[model samples]
Target: MTAMSLGPAYSRLWTATALSNLGDGIRSAALPLLAASMSTDPVIVAGVAVAGQLPWLLLGLIAGALVDRFDQRRLVVLVDCGRTALLAALTVAVLTGSATVAWIYAIAFACGVGETLRDTATATLLPPLVNDADLERANGRLVNAEVAGNELIGPPVGGYLFGVAMVLPIAINGGTLALAAALIFSLPSVFAPAPTSESKGRIWSETMAGLRWLVRSRRMFTLSLLSGTFAFVDSMWFVVLVLFVQQILELPAAIYGLLVGIGAVGGLIGGFLAARIVRLLGPAPTLTTCLLAAAAGQLMLGLASEVVLAALGLAATSAAFGVWIVVARTQRQRSTPRDLLGRVTSASTTVVMTASPLGALVGGLIGREYGLRAAILLGVPALVIAACLAYAVLRERREPAP
Candidate 1:
């Protein structure tokens, strides 16, 4: 398929992702607020955050193997359906006044499992749907859509809805999952079967092979490590941001949503412009530059005292990270073989995701011990380390002439 020919399918996929991600963003804010409303302990609220991501660390490999062995579209549909059902159940529990933190934790874990399945399948399915030449563009579009959904639409809506009724965000999240499932069902049947493997091997053996290849590739290894570090530091910011808004800046509850939404504007712009930037600077330079920009943004956030200044810094950081994500993901998608894509992506996701809970734990502890400002300032080093790693791993390279 030529790049132009792949446009329609890419559009369909991007739309579905954007819709689902909006729901994800709503849940991201709502869940924590729900926990906070129920309990005053920072540790417990952080635990809710940790539970949501725990599946990625534990079941990611298994999820990848399943994506490789089954129909990717069916897996996506099933996972989406499962999430919808789970969220609906939570909504019922909340409406009945029976919802507890434990219930939230269980639902969060289940949703995480579904997310793992959907993500692994999507990563594997994308390359085959688009032409090789269009992979970068497709990735950029998808990333941009995610930014719009998660950063732009979801957070602010979640805060407002939570103020009205806790069940509202959960219901909305459920509805979106159902819609996403319907979209997945409409995907072409070409993605039904896994690619042929030369050797018939057990799931464990195949999983090991995938992990080995990822670890053995110098560039892949470095990317995975940097990505994991990035996830950790970013998660720290996530945990502290709300507290910072409420406690330090003394901003209204609505500002949390507004600031996050504003920051998402950067992601939207980055996603839209990623392809052109890639063309101009080539992938390596683009990746390195964005990482450095993200580091600078994080540092600025740490230094800023005023809410507006902090939001600006965050917006810049988010935009830079958005572009960096597009560049790195495109490079990985272009470089990896189709058959190995699911496994490798899952492995990388597993590593990076593991860092999130750890970062949350550290952030919670640090915030409890010191202050939100201090906890946030600690993230600066992680960003710096990530930038340096990217620079070391991805040196300058010539761009292909159009």
Candidate 2:
């Protein structure tokens, strides 16, 4: 079926995901901005950023195994509920004047654990909700839910709300998670798949089943490597981005969200158009160009002096990111068997997730020692090298053997 035929279940799932994502975007922005208030030390500030991603590195493998073993829908609901509790506690902390960098770090890491499970489960949950032909289209809509909610609307609102009362946005973040859980609960019991008796015995073996496939697949492994490299570089660039914008570019704190928000327009557009682009360029060209975009966009932002150039550069980068994720996720789903989808998806994600914390640590140090300008410049060569390696891998795979 075409994307237009996506059923009620898929639509409901999408809505729930989008709602939570809106809240997630708010949490993602407000927390860092809040942490920034508690300390000027780039390491401390970047540490909170690291807390959010650290779980994916630590818990992603386990979560993927859990997703494959049990009901995905239930995991998502439980994770959302846990997030609600965490956000509520954070709101209380902020209102009570007890909010600390340590508190934020702990909460961020906990929430990230919830995210790692929910993300893998959600990806596994999706295929059952829609037809095979429309997976790409379905994924595109999901990306829009993420980009539009998280980056576009959420950040701008968060930037403004944090000024009114820091507690206000934190409270709202809890409420959204509650609502997302309620929506997810509306799904049928069939949403949870039963693991076959044979697959039940060993989590590690099940997990390894997916990893072995990834190691054996040139395309998936290469793509994962390329993505992992970029993930690392972007993490570093972003850790100090706010400081860069405020101090170096001299943009005021009030417009900070808008600065990131404008770039999200490219994400919104890319989400709408990724399938068309993939079809037009075909997977090889589409994947190759996405790498080029990553390198080029980072260079633009690093070299840009004025706010407008920076925004444009970011927009290009975000657009590329938007297309790249859709393409990667779509390729992943197409390649893996339905039974091992969770494990495979999680294993691949682990590679990308593993890099950001290191990047944050590095970015924090570089921005602290050299400057934010220098920190931003670091991504260019990394992405370029990744892009070149990816092109060679993709091209070489297509050539006829003797």
lDDT of each: 0.79, 0.81
Candidate 1 per-residue lDDT, tens place, 28-93, comes to 889989989899999999887678788887899877777777788888888899899999999999
Candidate 1 ranges beyond 4 A from true positions:
1-6, 29-47, 88-103, 162-168, 193-201, 236-258, 305-309, 361-388, 396-402
* Per-residue lDDT of model 2, residues 1-402, tens digit only: 333368888878888888888887888888888999888888888787679888888878767777877777888899999999998988888888998998999999998899888889888877777777777779988989987787778877887889888887888888988988987888777755564654576888878877887777788778887777777887888788789788888889866677766767878777778888977887767877877886788888888889888887787777877888888888777766666778878988998877766788899999899888888888888777777777778654342211
Off by over 4 Å in 2: 1-5, 29-50, 85-107, 155-167, 188-190, 194-201, 239-258, 305-309, 363-378, 395-402
The lDDT, on a scale of 0 to 1, for candidate 2 is 0.81
lDDT score of residue 59 within candidate 2: 79
- Please report the TM-score between candidate 2 and the true structure: 0.81
Per-model TM values vs. the true structure: 0.82, 0.81
User: Which ten contiguous residues of candidate 1 have the minimum total lDDT?
Assistant: 393-402
- The superposed Cα distance between candidate 2 and the true structure at residue 158, in angstroms, equals 4.2
